[model samples]
Target: MKLLSVNLGTARPVPFTDHPDGVTGIDKRPADGPVRVAAPGPKGTGGSGLAGDTVCDLRHHGGADQAVYAFAREDLDAWERELGRPLANGCFGENLTTDGLDVSGALIGERWRVGSEVVLEVTSGRIPCRTFQGHLGEPGWVKRFTRKGVTGAYLRVIAPGAVQAGDPIEIVHRPGHGVTAATQFRAVTTERELLPGLLAAGDALHPEALAAARKHVARYGG
Candidate 1:
């Protein structure tokens, strides 16, 4: 697989966000040059991992575990066909738009070496929120997206470096667990019974999902 485009966003005013600043970085565009990739510290404090990209709602985004977000270009094409509109490379607020990658189905904790430098690990799936729903302006978008369960993968930068469009992606590691970004999304959002099974992924799973699974097993007996 290869990187179709490396996208970055600038903070802009939005009417739908709960942030005190009322700004968001949901509108991303393909960058013209190579972008620096690094861990952005932790959640609620750090911002986007890609240099020059904005992450307005730090409380909910931009952290070491969620350093980068990736979505498949094919998925965007599918959405374009379904929505009957042109969706650009970074329309979904993703940093890396990939070609020929099964982003949604990628196993949790899978590691990908991008451009022979940066290494990123699959952490979790993007959970649709009010900001996303408002950004799209589609009625019942959150519910629709959850039901569709094609939520893209959030990545944690393992080895920082420069990444650009046309960079080749190599799958370097797979945890061999059956839990994928799509499967985790479904377990957390729709089917609670599957939460306990997500433990198979162990710490490679997102902290929030890991906690949910533990709670499910503790409360319901897995």
Candidate 2:
């Protein structure tokens, strides 16, 4: 699909902010069409255009779980409206922002290619936490996310490579299992009964989540 924004944190290790604390590069502008390259910005440390891994923390501070937020192409507008500003200077807090891809509905275990370098596998849904509330300055941000089921997806790197903002995204696989991001979120938060169905999803199941699902299935036996 189309590339929206490419974000990276700087290595300064300053206190976290509404934007990425250590933004090294940005790609919110597209060239030669809708596709844009999110290469290293002039402010970057090495100018290599590659953000070192681990800058993106999924489960650690962002939420209750390990991974948080795989953004979709459409949500960009909504986020802008909510934030009351344009997304630049690492404000969205997402490593890669894409357009024309329905990441909200992406199935767990699906893999997407970023250019020729990196692979992003859908692992889980972002469960809103207090941090999100603080960022949005809304008391009900988490509740809103739960009710809307618009929580972004969580992706793990299958491969690492340099990525820029305008890079085209290609879908490498459409998971055989039918489990979607909404289903996985329900399993984690509300419908404990759906846990078994998620495990039976087989290879389409994320490995990190598989262990818990199997353990639950052993007890639930649906």
Candidate 3:
């Protein structure tokens, strides 16, 4: 797999965003040169791992578990066909726009070495939210996206370094568990019965998702 483009965004006003200041960083553009990738902080306090990227919402977005969002160009193409419109790289607010990568099919604990230094772990699937639905201005987008279950993936920075466009992506680790990004999305969103199965992924899961899965097991005995 390859990193098609490295994208970054700044804070600006977005008309349909829920944030008082408006949603900005969602509109990422491709950038040249090496971009530093590091853990911002804790789950709720951190922004993008990429140095120049901004995370507008702390409570709902950004953190170690979601330091970087990745979406495949192939997935965007699929969405384009349904929406009948062009979707640009970084348009989904992802830091890395990847090519030849089955992001949704990635195992929850999978690790990727980007370029030569940066290592990122797959944590969870991106959850559709109001901000995302609003940004696209597509009616019933939340329901549509949820039904499609191709929510891309959230990643935690395991090794900090520089990443740039056209960098090669190397799979460093793959968990034996069968919990893929799409599987996790289904477990959390529609198939609550599958939550307990996610435990097989162990520490590879995002902390919050791990907690939620445990809670589901406790409450529902899944």
| Better model by TM-score: candidate 2 vs candidate 3 | 3
Candidate 3: 10-residue stretch with minimal lDDT: 16-25
Report clashes for each candidate as comma-separated counts. Answer: 0, 15, 0
- The prediction achieving the highest TM-score against the true structure is 1
Compared with the true structure, model 1 gives a TM-score of: 0.98
Whole-model Cα lDDT of every candidate shown, in order: 0.93, 0.58, 0.90
- Considering only N, C-alpha and C atoms within 3 Å, which residue pairs clash in candidate 1? none
Better of 2 and 3 by lDDT: 3
Candidate 1 C-alpha lDDT tens digits along 15-97: 99998999999999999989999999989899999999999998889988888999999999999999888988998999999
What are the candidates' C-alpha RMSDs? 0.7, 7.0, 1.1
lDDT (10s digit) by residue, model 2, range 43-152: 22313223342332322322212222357756767867875766452344455567888887888878788877767677677667555555546568678768777766
**Residue 31 deviation, candidate 1, in Å?**
0.6
Clashing pairs in 3: none
Distance from true position, residue 25, model 2, in Å? 14
